[model samples]
Target: MSEGAFKKYGKRTLVYLFLILMSIISVFPLYWCFISSCNNTQQILGGRMVPSTHLIENLKNLFAQQDVLNAFKNSVINTVLVLVLSLAICSIAGYGFEIFHDKGKDAVMAVIMMSMMVPFVAILVPLFQMFTKMGFVNKYIGYILPSLSTPFLIMLFRNNARTFPKEVLEAARVDGLSEFGIFVRMFVPMMRPTFAAAATITFMNTWNAYLWPKVVLQTPDSITMPMLVANLLSGYVVDYGVVMAGVTICTLPTVIVFFILQKSFTEAVAGAVK
Candidate 1:
């Protein structure tokens, strides 16, 4: 090979090596968790790296010792509701902010974005008191209410919306399509990647949420997966295997969602900056 070609190939090889190293670093904790879940407590304490045959045994212990099914059900319900509702509300808000021309819209968006700077903890106590008065404590509504819309998500959609084809909107309008119809039929399909990105972010955030849910969900029956895992660690005698099992279960859904939407998520995030 020519010297320049060899140099180019050498750089590509170095880049691949760097990426592989980073991938292993990123995935090692998940690998450890999965493997530990499949081993006995003794094996885990011994720093076992390989999978063992005790996975079913650990899972059975996990279910027997904890309300795995109930927690799983609650988490699924809360995550699904939050994901669906948040996406609908935020996407529409985003679409409107970008698609509809209004002199005051930018000011409204700036105010919304400013809210992101306020720590959630600042409102936690007040929100709890208000929810208590409203009788939403320990309810799914309490779980779903706080996350129904976020400024970052709205901004995500708005940025992507700016890239949407105005020509299509004009054509649809000329054909007698209403604004809602244009958004529903045309904007949604065109912005699928952004929606996928938003969905993945929302699902992951809602699923793995611990603090707000822990505070609002006062009843034992309303516990979520993160709460369940926290319970495992809270006991005086923590079982390594069972704890790992609980963590694996808790991590599974987000991992699945990310892998499924990873391509679109990447595309949408990259496009947002442009």
Candidate 2:
């Protein structure tokens, strides 16, 4: 082969090799978790890489010993509430900021944007104190409140809203459609990709959330999936198989949701300005 052809093929081969290596690196932990879930503790501790016949036993222990089903229910409740309220609030806020076009609103948005720089951990203590005073602890509200309106989500919608054609709004207004009506009927349908993207992100984050829920949810009845996994990991004797089983269950929903919305997610995120 010519030197130029050799160089071109070499570069392509190198790129493919790098990607394959990264894919293995990324997928290894998940593979390990699944394998561990299907193995006895001894097999796991001995670094077993292959699947075993212990998955049913591990799952049986998980369901019998832990509140696996209850945790699933709690996680679903919190995730659904957060996803619905967050999307509604952030989308509307984003629509208003972009469509309204005023200096005062812009100033308010600047302040809100400034909040993105403040880590949630920095305000976690204050939030806990405030929620405690409000008697929100151990309640689904406590789990759902903090995430109902995030700045990043609002910004995402706002940037995408800017790309929405203003002519549609003008025509709707000329036809005497109310602003709320227009938003509900026109804006939402047109932004399915963005909404799908937002839903995927919100669902995953809320589903996998550990720390905030851990701080608020105290009762056994209110425990989430992550908390359930943590519980499996705890106690005087830890069962690796059971813990891995719990982890697999906890991780499954987010994985499913991502795969379902992945195409829209990639499109919307790519189209997001900045």
Candidate 3:
């Protein structure tokens, strides 16, 4: 090869190496968790890496100690509801902010973006009080409702909405379609990639929510998988094997969701870059 071509190849090689290193660093903890979960308590304590025959035993122990199945069910329900409702609300809000020619729309969008800067803890007390008054304490609504007005998700949708084709809206209007009908039929189908990315993100966040769920869901039955994982460690004594098993189980659904949506997610990202 020419010297310049060799130099270009070397740069590409370095980039690939750097990406591989980063990938290993990111995935190592999850790999360790899975391997550790397969081992017995003694094996885990001894830092065993190779798979052991005790995985079934550890799984049994996990189920015996934590009602993880019930928590998993609750997580699935809460995540699905939040994902559907948030996408609908945020996407519509985004469409309005994008299509409608309102003078104050940009200011409203800025205010919404600024709301995301406030720390969740700062509003915890007021949020708790509001939830109490609204009668959402210890209910699924408590878990689902708090996530509906996600400014970040709305911002994501709005940014994606800017890339939407305007001619379709004009054509739909000429066809005598209502504004809502135009959005529902034309805009939504075209924005599938954006929706997929948003769904993956929102589902993961809802599924993994711990602190707010723990605070509002006072009842044992209302608890989620993350809460169940936290409950695994009692004061001093911690069961390493069962905890690892529980974590692995908790992580599975998010991984599945990502894989399912990965194509659209990648397209959305690439489109944004373009």
- Model 3 residue 153 CA deviation in Å: 1.7
lDDT of 2 by residue, 1-274 (tens): 6999999999999999999999999999998997789998899999999999999999999899988899899999999999899999999999999999699999999999999899889989999999999999999999999999988789889988997898999999999999999899999999988898888878878898989999999999999999989888667888899999999999877777677888866665664547
Residue pairs that clash (backbone atoms under 3 angstroms), model 3: none
Q: Tell me the deviation in Å of residue 197 in model 3.
A: 0.8
Question: Which number leads on TM-score?
Answer: 2
The deviation in Å at residue 236 for candidate 1 is 2.0
Model 1 lDDT tens row, 1-274:
6999999999999999999999999999999999999999999999999999999999999999998999999999999999899999999999999988487998899899899899999999999999999999999999899899898888889988998888998999999999999999999999887888888878888999999999999788999999999999887888899999999999988888788888866765575556
By lDDT, the better pick of 1 and 2 is 1
Task: Spell out the clash pairs found in candidate 1.
Answer: none
Q: How many residue pairs clash in each candidate?
A: 0, 0, 0
Provide the global lDDT of candidate 2 against the true structure. Answer: 0.90
C-alpha lDDT of residue 254 in model 3: 78
lDDT of 3 by residue, 25-140 (tens): 99888888888889887898898878888789889999988788899999889988998999999989988887883779988988888888899889889999999999999899
Candidate 3 displacement at residue 16 in angstroms: 5.8
